[model samples]
Target: MPTARIYQRPKNAMQSGKARTDRWQLEYEPAEPQRPDPLTGWAGSGDTRGQIRLGFPTMEAAVAYAEREGVAYTVVPAPTKTLKLQSYADNFK
Candidate 1:
């Protein structure tokens, strides 16, 4: 039988060949430096060193702020966003 053409050769023939593609990638994603957060995997213990505290009349208020800020901060990927945003005002009684 006549030898098969190079392109039609079976893969088991042990021939080395290069591939060509008509398709091309459009946009290339930017390369970013990925590093784990230093404070990640933190175990919430009773340690307040170098940390800020929230002061509210009721424990519920503090808890609510904590939960809201935590969720919003993560949901929004803006450098200007922060969970420590505070509102303070004094009203004369």
Candidate 2:
């Protein structure tokens, strides 16, 4: 059985911007363990089913895609972080 993970893209930690935040990503959790490549010595997985990432503008779109593909998925909610308001004048104080 394949399981899909749906999650919202987080705003950049250093800088908060709308860029990339509106998109949601649907990814497949690898069902098989990763193995090292014999020649290159790089870790790789034999199962490629869940390696692709599908991005959607809305959560509904992502969910719909998963449903249409007959993929069992679990939604991972984005963490909430509150920003404290500040003013440039406060720096002079």
Candidate 3:
């Protein structure tokens, strides 16, 4: 059996937009460690499951799928976001 993790997507650091952050994602734990390829020196892994990512509209849906598949899974709570309210004028201070 493979172990998986369920969590909500976080906002991308490169952009101010919050698009796609509402979806939950399921990712399998690495079955094997990555090793540098002998030819290209790029990191590679034989575990194809590591490349798979499943998205669900809600956390419950994600968990249900994992349960139906008999996959051992752990739900990682999403990190809380704290907003600091400030006006553009504050930048001048």
- Comparing 2 with 3 on lDDT, the higher-scoring candidate is 3
Note the Cα lDDT for every prediction shown. 0.30, 0.88, 0.98
Ranking under TM-score, best-scoring first? Answer: 3, 2, 1
Q: Model 3 segments beyond 4 Å from truth?
A: none
- Native RMSD of candidate 3 (Å): 1.0
Residue 26 of model 3: what lDDT?
Answer: 100
Worst 10 residues of 1 by lDDT: 1-10
lDDT of 1 by residue, 1-93 (tens): 111111111122355442321111111122333445568954344323214422344334434554555422111111242366555653333
Best by TM-score: 3
User: What does the lDDT come to for candidate 2?
Assistant: 0.88
Instruction: Report how far off residue 20 is in candidate 1 (Å).
Output: 75
lDDT of 1 at 39: 80
lDDT of 2 by residue, 7-53 (tens): 99887878856698878999999989889999999999879975699
Model 2 regions lying over 4 Å from their true place: 14-16
| Worst window of 10 by summed lDDT in candidate 3 | 43-52
TM-scores of all candidate predictions against the true structure: 0.22, 0.83, 0.93
